[model samples]
Target: MKHYLRPEGSPPVNGYSHAVAFSGTSVAVSGQVPVDAEGRIVGEGDPEGQLRQVFVNLRTALAAAGAGMADIAKLTVFLTDLADLGAFRKVRDEFIDVERPPACSLVQVVGLVHPAFRVEIEALAVLPVESVQPG
Candidate 1:
């Protein structure tokens, strides 16, 4: 279970909540870059493509931890260019539920460890014990 918060007087958040609360096993995922399982770089210069791949990578990591995007309570996005914020959000809506969007922070970075990468995102997800049942 999760609860989202939006302060009474704070300015409206366009795509995210002010805070989120959850109880259960929490999983912290590493910042995901646009790379395939083979470690091959993807979407080298396209922010939209890169952002999409980043989400794909995030989903894979979450699945490994017995969670999914719907279980995420918070997210931190790192971008080399803020100009891509619109595109980033567009692709995000395709994966995350806008009605119960998680608390998020997007930061502009000078660079990532990889020159071809333009976006990276890390997420925190809370999973109920039942969700961890063995397959």
Candidate 2:
């Protein structure tokens, strides 16, 4: 994957790239919330804890598709409050490569599917052709 961190005319980025280029089997991961496998909310009103669970869910979902966090090319994040941006970035860095971050878009929404959910993240990844297995 190629990360266009600072394109010629693009503005400086904080923790994401302007764009990403990759050739492989495309994998689309649905939006993930801060719920565990049992559907129980992991964090109540804490942004850090909520973001952590979201990342964990993303990892599990990616693995099921034969991909990992490093395979991700882009991310779409939704937060009920923009104030959680700091916690979001802190937790996100734990899962994604900081040096070659994926293209990302963050949106502040009024609320998520569940009122208890503070954040939701969706990812787009590319798995190398050789990594794809016959099913």
Candidate 3:
């Protein structure tokens, strides 16, 4: 994938690319909340901890689809509070490639599926054509 961190005439970006260009088998992961496999919320009233769990869920979903964090081309992040943006970036850098980050859109929503949830993330990834096999 080609990451345009700052396209011509575009303003600077903090931790995401302005655009990403890629061609392959698309994988769409559903919005992942801060829940464990057993359906228990991982973090209670902690933004950073909740964000970590969300990333874990995202990783699991991506792996199930034969993709990894590096293959992600886009991300849609939802946060209940904008104040947690710092924590979000810190946790996000742990999962994604900081040098070649994916295109991202962040929204500060009034609430999520659960009031206890502080963060949710969905991803769009592309598996290289060569990596895909006929089924």
Candidate 4:
């Protein structure tokens, strides 16, 4: 995948690229947030609940991108509280298998979208070429 700024006239990218392109049979998705169906916050102040919601959102985003958990190669998480490690692992292991789990990263961030939010996650995936359509 090639990550690039949208374009000069396009909105500026702070640290992340405005767009990413995939030429291989796989796609890697960034960690998704815990926004709900109405695009509102869920699991306020609850790391475990919030992490679960992050997974759900990631699945939805991957589906829209023509991928799934089995296609994932890596999963990275960002959290506001390092003390939530236990909770994080509990939630992380739920969806991922031990045999060949994707590479993972967990970082402690100063803050997130809202002060109440405790976690956010992103992923790297490898979808079958036949399943991918160029964006």
Residue-wise lDDT of candidate 3 within 1-135, one digit each (tens)?
A: 999999999998999999999999999999999999999999899998999999999999999888999999999999999999999999999999999999999999999989899999999999999999676
Model 3 local distance difference test score: 0.95
The residue-by-residue lDDT of candidate 2 on 1-135, one tens digit each, is 999999999998989999999998999999999999998999899999999999999999999999999999999999999999999999999999999999999999999999999999999999998888988
Residue clash pairs of candidate 3? none
**TM-score for all predictions?**
0.93, 0.98, 0.98, 0.74
Superposed model 4: Cα runs more than 4 Å off: 1-23, 133-135
Listed per model in order, the count of residue pairs whose N, CA or C atoms clash below 3 Å is 0, 0, 0, 5
The candidate, 1 or 3, that scores higher on lDDT is 3
Q: Tell me, what's the RMSD of every candidate?
A: 1.7, 0.7, 0.7, 10.0
**Candidate 4 lDDT by residue in tens digits, 67-112:** 8765667667898999988887887677765444565667999998
In lDDT terms, how accurate is model 1? Answer: 0.89
When summed lDDT is taken over every stretch of 10 residues in candidate 3, the lowest stretch is: 126-135
Q: How many residue pairs of model 4 clash at the backbone?
A: 5
lDDT on C-alpha atoms for all candidate structures: 0.89, 0.96, 0.95, 0.73
- What's model 4's TM-score? 0.74
Q: What lDDT tens digits, residue by residue, belong to model 1 across residues 59-129?
A: 99999988999999999999999999998999999999998999999999999999888899999999987
